[model samples]
Target: MAAQGDNRPIGVFDSGIGGLTVARSIATSLPHESIYYVGDTKRCPYGVRSESEVRSFVLQAGRWLAAHDIKIMIIACNTATAAGLKIAQQMLPVPVIGVIAPGARAAINSTRTRKVGVLATPLTVRTGAYTRAIRDLDAGVSVYGCPAPSFVEIVENELATGAHLQERWLQDGDVFDTPENREEVARTLGPILEPGIGIDTVVLGCTHFPLLVNPIRHALGEGVRVVSSAEETTRELTDILVRREQLAEDDVVPEHRFATTSDNIAEFAAAGSFIFGQPLKSIEHISLDELDRY
Candidate 1:
């Protein structure tokens, strides 16, 4: 007789809906596993917040998810991961996975020049998590950490305005395709694109960065390779599940549930649907005080 598979849902949390990119990748990679995602949108843009604040926020979200009986948890925000991953792992009941290490490993594998550029939130860059992770993996690699403090706001603004609702926006191009947006992205990305940097691989350190990939790619030019930790993180999740025999059974149907700390649940659903590549059937508005009870 074969060992039974665990059917509990995987928990994923981020500062905002940006983490949907990681949740989407997990759903695609592990179709049989269910997912419970929490987005703390009420106090988003964790990149600009203090390290202690980000850590506190990460724990509140993690504890809430853990109380819901999730099998595992993934800290989908790069800033949160940088600030709170170790403590979350120690405090949470389930296994905790962070995006930075996987992203660093992926960047290392993709870089041919051994010079990798990391575009992330201000706090993430300040923490030097990606730089540390990359160098720890391979001391020969040169890591450049660039702060893109405006990128998250750009993504959140688009999501708030229902830009994601337009089929053309989703299928054809995003807000970054506009001349104004293009200029903004280019200017913000100037440091990494400098001739002296000569990086062949660029890591999207924040989950939100993936939504702006088209514009980012345009700015970086054709020679640079863009990498997102979403896929690599999902791969790590799969390996852990397989080792623990916790992979959802083939016969089990997968269900996805979403929650947000924002008052505007509708906006979250709309943006989440766009990022998740499917209409979100279940979405609930959660409160910070409620999460504290967990």
Candidate 2:
């Protein structure tokens, strides 16, 4: 007799709506599985927070999700992963995965010139996680870390609003293509885009970065390949589930649940809907106090 499939939902958490990128990819890759996503929007942009603070927040989120009976937990924020992955793996009851290693692996595979650039949060770059992961995979390859501190703000505050929510921005009049945004992106990415860099591939080290891919690609030019861990991370999740016989059965009808720490559910829903590529019918607001109880 074959083993029965596990129907428990996957838990994914990020500093803000950025994790929806990873969650969306997982939903597409594993249609039968449900997902429980937690976005700590109130304390978002974890990129700037101290490592200790980020780790504490990550654990709180992980514990809260684990308490809800999730089979696996994914730290979808690059900063959270860099700061808390090891400790989360030690403390969480279920399997815990983060975006960093998978993203580093994807960057390594995408680079033809063996010179890769990483665009991530200040904390993520400061941690040297990507450089360590990439070099561990291939010591011959060179990894350059570039901190784009304002990129997260651009995604969460700018792109998630106004015309961007309508999907029109994705068409010819991309929001990232605006003069102001173009100048900002160019300025922020100048270090990596420098001629001497000679990087053939760049990794979107933060989940939020993928949403700004159009502008990032434009700045990097046609010669550079951009990589995100959304697909690679989902692949790792699939393999883990298969090995543990926890893959959801084909007959399972998946349900996705969204929760946010933000006080305004409407705004979170709107931004989330845009990021998740679907209408978010319901979203629960979770407070830091409530999360602390877990």
Candidate 3:
């Protein structure tokens, strides 16, 4: 809750640049508030890590945000949210929100056939996090899970627009992040997505998956609806903030700050601009070594 003299910005962090998707949604949805976003680029993919490691990584980011005096914290990464939302919320004094619940709720609400599909990282699938969340929300709903480690590669390589996504994502045998492998990756994942006889709604369970939503939608066709956590998470945050009186009242032009654990300014700027749909500013680099000490 925004206490006395508490106009501090909301702090958001993810395992990597993909959480920019969530930051962008909040920036547009709640334009008056300031947001501080951090991407753990050095540990780009947290989905495959152990639960303890994920908890530690998430708390490190959370504690940093708390020290910065943020009134609210957003675990923008789905994997992080799946791994650490409950503990982080209990540990933190302020309101902490994540993407999974909202997205799961939205998926349950949107599926007319009660059959839902989830495309996520190997960690998300292995954790069975999304499946459990959706089932807990509505036992009537069925969730199908797909692990997508390749999606990260496509984003990392900045090759989503071309055929390269196919080779890197589906085939599962390549060390290269190039256009030449896209077809293989696409074909590898295509069989599951090709006109599924069961699922009517598909969930993009990873932050990186949203970057591939267009092609994914194409592959699944109009019958299988797609759900992403971005907009839903923003909406959920807004509701919670309003209830808690943490939402800003005025329509002030908002300022956004972006940071990363790695010193890759160009990659940060590129992905951030695409998500924010504007020229991103205030990009900073802070390593885990320094962050861990605090």
Q: What is the per-residue lDDT of model 3 for residues 39-151, given as tens digits with 9 covering 90 to 100?
A: 89888778778888888888888888888788899998888988888889989777898888888988998899898888887777777888888999998787777777767
RMSD (CA, angstroms), candidate 1: 1.6
State candidate 2's TM-score.
Answer: 0.96
Clashes of each: 0, 0, 8
Q: Write the per-residue lDDT of candidate 2 for residues 44-130, one digit (tens) a residue.
A: 889999999999998899999988899999999999999999999999899999999999999988899999999999999999999
Candidate 1 stretches greater than 4 Å from native: 1-4, 168-172
Model 3: CA > 4 A from native: 1-6, 159-197
Model 2, position 57, has a per-residue lDDT of 94
- Show the colliding residue pairs in model 2: none
Question: Model 1: which ten-residue window has the lowest total lDDT?
Answer: 161-170
Clashing pairs in 1: none
Q: What's the TM-score of each model vs. the native? A: 0.96, 0.96, 0.86
